[model samples]
Target chain A: MPEIILIDDPADPRVAAYRDVRERDLVGREGLFVAEGEVVLNVLARSTLCEPASLMIARKRVAGLADLIARLPEDVPVYSASQEAMDAVVGFHIHRGILALGRRRAPASAADMLAGLGEGALVLALSGIANHDNMGGLFRNAAAFGVDAVLLDTDCCDPLYRKAIRVSVGAVLVTPFATAQGDLLEVLTAAGFETVALSPGGATRLVDLKRPSKAAVLLGAEGPGLAASVLARATTVAIPMATGFDSLNVATTGGIVLHHLAFAALRD
Target chain B: MPEIILIDDPADPRVAAYRDVRERDLVGREGLFVAEGEVVLNVLARSTLCEPASLMIARKRVAGLADLIARLPEDVPVYSASQEAMDAVVGFHIHRGILALGRRRAPASAADMLAGLGEGALVLALSGIANHDNMGGLFRNAAAFGVDAVLLDTDCCDPLYRKAIRVSVGAVLVTPFATAQGDLLEVLTAAGFETVALSPGGATRLVDLKRPSKAAVLLGAEGPGLAASVLARATTVAIPMATGFDSLNVATTGGIVLHHLAFAALRD
Candidate 1:
């Protein structure tokens, strides 16, 4: 068990990494991935692939978390502060007083991910998914349905963005992903992945979705979604959207298609 | 068309509704609700339930929009600006020169919605689903499938919040949503709605979804999700998440579940 350090002062430089957490709303030098709440922190600390740089817990809430904090690496700092100071450092009220920050691992390259996954599996290929929270949600959906991996094209938000890390509930850390080169279509083509571009207005219906030898689903940002070229880059498929209604979001669409694939795979 | 009041000046009070578009981000005020692009504005124009107080478009974009804009009574202002001034009013650059500002409609009541829905139809009831975008996505999914209507609890973020309305492609305006008075369990139960609470850890698997007499699904906010009391209020059904994943967002979960209900109803 690592000994917890008591620092009631908000000015302690040791806790500086957690300072003004709301400042994360604006862009910053990206490296450290910030995680919120005990659930995400516990997931990070426990994952063999993730190691926390430090942990912060308000003294009042420390009793329930002693067991989890005890397991941190001996040198990892566990700073204890009054709830007030913790709140000040984070720049807003945090009901869950405990938070953990971890170092960002270099993401695998697209070629490496393709090599690792081998031949046939359904995976997510993201384009222009600029919102960090939406990016996280997309990853969360990908992981929830066991997509082989995610291939992020250029212009997508960094998966390690702090809000993304928090929003994913650490699922981004678990879901294997890579920064793919070139447009989504070209990458999938070179990798021998069948690109399936999802569209609302396209002629194909979702009920007609068929399993491919190696499938990669391409989704664009919400509203002004996948650029026409981005759409042009794939063997397009349309979800069976009801008439007089709009379509599912990119993230939700991923989940539905992934679930559909999973079901078909089981029957096969 | 209400004589195209073209103003070159950004300060023209006629376009006051379009001024300071981003101010809503800094503070919540009753004055903010924006609909963007032609598709959304068309829904607004056709909706007798909600009126667009005004419409804004570039002189060229207005060519095909004449009959749509003409439907508004003459006094209801249809403001236009040179493309440059319109950009100035919106803060960030927007190519969707056609915009409209409408008086926020009075929120509809929940009791009426429960009574109004068909006995065997689907309804999506949202609990504390605060993210404006998630609400938008949920509406998109609801409309995409054949869900009867969206019923929001008291604690929800406003569906008509500018971002939600736009993200939903203005489906939020057309979808017959009504805010309920009591807790979801009480209002929905009193109206003979069978509540299906969605949880990742839920024991009852979705593959076994039954044809219900009348159905409403209660989805919680992302992360901390449905309160225990709320979960207790419904017959719990689990979306079979893949190995090692937590769950999907409120909207995606709603979409998948609605898909099942739609299938069940269609088969029946």
Candidate 2:
């Protein structure tokens, strides 16, 4: 069982990491990120890839989370504080009354993650998905569709940000993702994966494409879609849309394409 | 041409409807709602179902929006204010430099909207979707996939809410939508539509369902899914998901299911 520490002071050195979370998020959280709410905390406890550094809970909610608290590693400290004190420490009203600080393991290289997947793997590759909400939604969709892994280009936002984690409903904690800097298409191609780039201008419609044994769908950010050079290298497919309508949000687009791949695999 | 009026004072009674928007959103906007940003303003201008009462724009952005401004009805007033003045009036920075007060037409009944769609119509029916962002996203997805119309149970949030309109990229302005107090499924069934209710414990996996000539997908808000009674009245369909995973966001689910129906219709 984890040690239960009592916290009375908002400025306690032990809980210093939890201070002004939103401002810290903007500057970067170094190697650590905060996960909020009971649902996310439960997910954090279950994740094998992420290590929880500590946990903070409202005093009133401790009894409800006893089982979850007991599951933490012996060395991990669990702290309980009055809701007022906890709110002051976090610099926000954490209405859900639970939070955990988690550290990510060293990220796998995109090449390494792709190499580990089986021959029939389904992957989601994203480019320039700078919006944190979109990034979180993509991770949530990837997990729902049973995507093997997600690959992000250098420009993609950090999925571990608190808002992203909350938006994902903790899916980012479970979904394995990696970032690569250059020539993501070349890396994907070299892995023997059939790459399909989603674009408004495409050679084929999404529904018409034959399901491949190993497939990766490439998605770009919302407004400025995939670069022309990137589309040139892959089999370009468009989600058939109403004439003169704006394209679907990038996360929604990813969900549809991933759904197609997932159910297509089930049929095979 | 819209009469361009220069307003120097922030507290001008002419623009009284535009004050403290966030606070006003909580109480209500009477029959009026604000549409912000260039894209949404253009969409609001083109909407035949909604009428714009007035427009408030940053003076600097006037020249760029000349074509859009000219398209507005002659009776509609266009008020241009300096940036600082506009900010003081709206109680927030109007960074997009465009705002329009639009009034919804007296809503059509669910039965009425359903009666108007053709025999091969595709519709989205929603229940208890109170979140503004989800409401907006549903509209955006509906428009992207060419859904003929949207039907909402009385429990759903207002799609005309400012945040919903913004998140939808203005899709809500153009898509025809209606709300009914009870038994929305019955209305669809009476209209000769096959209604499919989305739930995690659905009887049919989404990909396996054959396309119907006229289909309406019923989606519930996340967390508490469709009520058992509601699902009992329609064909319950589940998105085949990975085991132990929560379901997709309601909007994303709508996107995938609608994508299926849209593509299926094309093939037929």
Poorest 10 consecutive residues by lDDT, candidate 1 chain A? A259-268
lDDT of 2 at B155: 90
State the lDDT of candidate 1 residue by residue for A102-207, as single tens digits.
8755666888777666556777998889988788888888878878888888889888777787777678877778777687678777888888787776555555
Report model 1's interface C-alpha RMSD after superposition on the true interface residues: 1.6
Residues B6-40 of candidate 2 have per-residue lDDT tens digits of 98898899888888988898999998989999998
lDDT of 1 by residue, B1-268 (tens): 4777887888888786677777864475465467888888988887755778778787678778888877777777777678888888777676867888875566557787678877677888998888898898888888888777788888899887888988787878777888876788888888888888887766587757775778888898877877887777578888777776756777888877887677653324
User: Candidate 2: lDDT of B65?
Assistant: 96
Q: Looking at candidate 1, what is the lDDT of residue B192?
A: 86
CA lDDT of B4 in candidate 2?
A: 95
Best by TM-score: 2
Model 1, residue A262: distance off in Å is 2.7
> The CA-based lDDT of model 2 is what?
0.89
Candidate 1 local Cα displacement, residue B108, angstroms = 6.8
Q: What DockQ values do the models have?
A: 0.57, 0.85
In candidate 1 the C-alpha lDDT for residue B155 amounts to: 84
Clashing pairs in 1: B110-B179
Return the clash pairs for model 2, or none: none
Question: Deviation in angstroms for B55 in model 1?
Answer: 5.6
